[model samples]
Target: MHWISMIGIALAANLDNLGIGVSFGARSTRVPFISNLVIAILSMIAAYLSITLGMVISQYVPSNYANWGGGALIILIGIYAVISDYKSNSKIQNENGITSYIHSPNKADKDNNKVISWKESLTLGVALALNCVVGGFGAGVTGLSPIMTTLFIGLFSLLTVDIGVRAGQQIAKTLIGKWFNLLGGVLLICIGLYEMFV
Candidate 1:
């Protein structure tokens, strides 16, 4: 029962990663495999760090306070997501006095493209990993052992996110539509608040 609950918690926490991956994949026809791999690696590292920090902090803080802190962090992330989505939707008038919709490339064009730079991959990896940690910390405060829970959460989250990215890449060329990242953001905020206060 404990393991089942832990896995469920991990899955719920990773929904943000899935949503982010979908957004990224929706914006790019080609899923950068190397970038995804880097994301996975960085997520593992962040999960490790978050779990370690949580363990140490749990010793000093009341359990309820720790949970609330985690919940607050998640809420902040949710707000950021909503803001980012809105910004992405805003129209920008180019210096050429023209406005164009941002569109992803076709699959054929992407297949012939060069690999993304390591530096770019690293930056994306770090950002995605940080997101994982914030979500992971919130889920971890439920008394599960951090190390094992972090490992499972990181691994499974990466797997699910990669799947979403790949699927998005395949259809991105044909799916030139806007996604409401704000929906996920709102969901995150509600979940975080419920966890903290309920």
Candidate 2:
């Protein structure tokens, strides 16, 4: 059961990486191995920090309350992601660092270098990691292992980005492709519900 929850959280966290990877791929932008590694490392660290905070919160709150509360927060975030993507509100989304990058992955390739350097990757890493911070807390509250989840999140992030880039514009062009991250959102909802009941 913990394994299920662990896998679910990892998968949910990295789906956006795949979409962003596809965005990079579509524009011929490159996410070098080092840059990708940097992103993964940052994501892992962020997840760990948030999960620890959640564990702390879990300690102070009743198990049921913590479970329900964390699950509810994750569900709300998931729903927001789905609705925001569906609505495509430029004014608001444009101001969002990550959302804007999701729309134009090439922006990460500053200097028009086509390749994302490890140095340039810092911002990307932070932006991507922020997406999973809240969910990391939720999973931690539900008793997921911080180490395992962090490791899985990092592995999945690295793989998804690499594969998505390899799959390239083809993946981004598919009908369902546009909603890829939204699928992750749905998975978050399912994970939240699972944490609540099981």
Find the candidate with the highest TM-score and give its number: 2
Output the lDDT of residue 83, model 1.
Answer: 89
Q: Which candidate tops lDDT?
A: 2
Tens digits of per-residue lDDT, candidate 2, 1-198, equal 478878888888988788888878887889999999999999999999998888888998887798788788778878887887677644445455564665666777889988989987888888889877998999778778899999999999999889888887898678655777688889888888877878
Regions more than 4 Å wrong, model 2: 89-93, 96-99
What does candidate 1 score on TM? 0.60
Q: Give the C-alpha lDDT of model 2.
A: 0.83
| Cα displacement (Å) at residue 161, model 2 | 0.5
Return the clash pairs for model 2, or none.
none
lDDT of 1: 0.57
